[model samples]
Target: MSKCIQGLSLGVLCLVLVSTISGALSHEGSVALSHEGVGRKQNVTYDGRSLIIDGRRELFFSGSIHYPRSTPDMWPDLIAKAKEGGINVISTYVFWNAHEPVEGKFNFKGRYNLVKFIKLIQKQGLYVILRIGPFIEAEWNHGGFPYWLREKPGIIFRTDNQPFKYYMKRYAKMIVNMMNKNELFAPQGGPIILTQIENEYNNVQQVFKERGADYVQWAGNMALKLNTGVPWIMCKQKDAPGAVINTCNGRNCGDTFTGPNSPNKPSLWTENWTAQYRVLGDPPSQRPAEDLAFAVARWFSKHGTLVNYYMYHGGTNFGRTTSSFVTTRYYDEAPLDEYGLVREPKWGHLRDLHRALKLSRKALLWGTHSNYSLGHQLEARVYQNSEKNVCSAFLANNNTREAATIYFQNVPYYLPPRSISILPDCKTVVFNTKKVNAQHNARTFHHVKDFSKGMRWKMFKDSIPNTEDTPVQNSLLLEHYNATKDTTDFLWYTTNIDVGSNDLPLLNSIKPILQVASWGHAVHGFVNDLYVGSSHGDHVQSPFSLNKPITLKPGKNKISLLSMTTGFPNSGGYMEHKIAGVSKVLIQGLMTGTQDLINNIWGHQVGLLGEKLEVYNPRSSKKVKWVDAKGHDHEPLIWYKQ
Candidate 1:
């Protein structure tokens, strides 16, 4: 029998179910987490069912918390809050670009100190998952690979090429040696229970044909050679070789993803995307707390053993680390916001889910799993543990629009539409995915005292290139990347087109259509100091195009086309070949004929004058005038900083 203790709005309620099962847990549904500190070795293994930690079959609730995403000062609060939120495993990607921005040069200081980050998690008694992807495409720039790597001679990324393999081996070995010296592996009792290599490479391997399969095998072998003494995983890699476990990554991996490829490996969901990352100019996304809980329950119901939320904290994308069109704020509607603040309901609801799952972990890990159809669109997934004389069960309702009532173990239980109820003892209805008992908290932002009294700001205008300055002249407009070398986002292509008084209509037309094609992501056109037009496109989408009718004087007319980039793509087929700047220029819609301007004598400028003058640095020694910018045009081509 069930009793309703309190009622809430919107059909929410609190329940207490009377227990009748004689078989209960040994410790009465309490979780004991005791792994912490360093200098202790552990024997970690896995089976088709779950991970065996020190000979004990275990299930984990994991979350991703990128260390470089935030500073060291914020690590404590973020990690402590995560521990308090019931996350036992803290996963992170060791960004290669952040560690080794240049070839043969390395850095591991401040936020990039991976050792310090792992130690902090150990201090909190949580396990760590080191995803040393070298090519992590978590909306990270260049997919976390160093820009210098792209310049290597005859090197193909993520393939079986010798140049690529040599460098990959060196980097991977360096990381392994570092971890080994520090004794960070679980066998060394340092909280790092598992490590991953070569992220999501399987997504693009099919294009490589047989070479792709060979590369996969080689990568797996190389990673396994490191001997981290813990199981290695490859997310989204279906053809993962040997003992390396292939995991799943997606929004909902329960119904869509099958079990792991190998029967001896347990089902692992490495990246359960809480919500999609926000793109620039797009509104924030929200994944309903109820739906997230339902997905979690569904995964566990389908015999999933270890689950990791892609981003539990989803911190801010500091500096220029964001990839492509993604925003600097990568909060992604996670349980923890960009500033490490706890999001209501998501944080609390997931915490409750973790606790309830831990309660039944013993049964789920060790007991035999089976499914039975209870009724229409309803099923019961039961875990029977005859060894301990205790069992657990999940009552799931697959119906989308209606609640379900099903009889299980001679008891009639109510399941809400598309939800699951957990019975830790097969009798007591302990928790339900649809029932959120935690306090629904709402927060308010309040400004501090003396908000804007002493605020002083200076701005600088990024001026266009004048005719007096000698630009880098080239017979052919250089490719954007080769010209700028990734130093700046702006590239200017300036040219002077002569129009005679007695010329044809195509050359002297008053309002001719000046067209430019494929300028990376965005472009701005100017004809003789007047802004003609601008155009933009997503970098991953089609090439950009700018077509504007221009009023050119019947003489030497200066045309300046400024090309802009969002950020380099971190993931895609042949992303290295992506380029910016206009390849073809044309002036059409004339009575005579069209005029092609590709062969014109073009002058190129890598960046803006504001960039050259160091205007962003307030204390620079250069004597540059600062404009208040209070009444100036606030459109593009202006630099503002505080």
Candidate 2:
């Protein structure tokens, strides 16, 4: 056999070998991989015009639907919806934080069951794109790295630093090993075909510095070294090394970027954003179905082959896992809301457009192309093979709201505002974003009542006394605690010291200056049961000053702080040592000039009474005047009932 054939045959052999090994290796039952090496061995051909999948050059449609975004119960329906919308693949990011909440602990029993999720996709007869971004920054908290990582010492993230590489390699191995053991690769007849490493690194490429290049190289090498026998992709990574294929992302990419290396590598759009995420104070933003369809048309007419909708079904950000906490994680302007209801117009309009675009599959998937810019933001393109068997055409207007007419090779075409025109036969305009031909359907679900609707409430003072037991002799005597196996956001540090009559004046009038250190993303303070205030951190560091006046009742007073985290520090630079709690809580109102109380004998507490009660769930709800259900819109102690 020739070397090429031998290599190809070995590839095939490795596929079966891996699958067989996986089947035997699985602690559970055997896992399946889809047609992994078949496309390669079949001599898949492609140009600027078409993608030949399984020996046939054809147009392919894909959509993004991360399994972690929704529950397994919702998977079948979401996949069915995508297929109904004319999608061929299910793209997702394997959230590392969700999978590994603690350092060595992994829980894939429920929603974190990536294996089951992939198997479910395969059962639906759909392809899969597994984006294993140990560093996925999908508007996720701490960019999806667990807060436990932030507890580590001197561990800078996404760099060539020894600590980071150590953890990154360990995590990558855990995931790859799981997938391989289950034969989740294509060689194992599983649905996954494409795999991604990291996410949008190019968007933050400047942050990596010179080490960025080396870090990219290290990531690619580590990922490829797994020998998954499938291609690895990096989005927005224009300078990706030879081993990793760099792909595109954005509202429009086919016209703006080209393949970094071999044309054999197909054009893949990783994130075709359907709508923008919601921001505070901004009205809910949405993309009209027509504009979205027009963008797809432009890509198809330009000989683009693979297009994945950034999110065919936008799922909810359940729990604190949603992006906004201090900012606003309640972003639900997706094609589908957090409740799984499809957004109007954009959903139906895009559905019909997907069907129409599919009709041009042959012309789009096969023919080579030529482009003609008709000027004035209007462009034209023609695609066909020399055999004269297949042809397609595209017309588009870049203007946001102006309509135009342009003659392309003697054929008059009408371009709508910010729209694209697709012609499967180079004659008829079959799909236009400006036009809608599908029925718009709206879905809404009844809200479930509180889980703690009828529970009782009881408050007991914690036995630990106060922070005065140990008076600091100097400013440098403050202490820090590391939360190890104890992963809750709460940490308690209490000490006590006496203040004589002279010292009483300094502390009483001294504003009771207390400085605290904690890794909690959110911290609440209390002095003798009086609510001091609450301070929240951004993506990093829980640094703030409690300028509120604190009084000492003659002898001793209890000072408590409750720190909470939406999710632990999962990944970053020196993330392990990322100080989250009150790094420095100063009583600055009492002191001025150089004598500020940035440091003091601090009594720190990690969590709140509400958290210990698990107040978020109704099953833990109790009846207390200050804590019981009032109405939904009340403040402070307000609770809601069924």
**Best TM-score goes to which candidate?**
1
RMSD of 2: 11.2
For model 2, the stretches where C-alpha displacement exceeds 4 angstroms are 1-52, 147-154, 255-259, 278-283, 323-331, 409-411, 441-465, 468-486, 489-522, 535-546, 549-555, 567-578, 588-598, 609-642
Kindly list the per-residue Cα lDDT of model 1 for residues 312-404, writing each as its tens digit.
Answer: 988878777888788888865899888888887889999988877877876787777777666667777777666666578888888889986
TM-score of each: 0.91, 0.78
Each candidate: how many clashes? Answer: 0, 51
In candidate 1, how many Å is residue 197 off? 1.1
In model 2, the worst 10-residue window by lDDT is 12-21
lDDT of each: 0.80, 0.61
lDDT of 1 at 66: 94
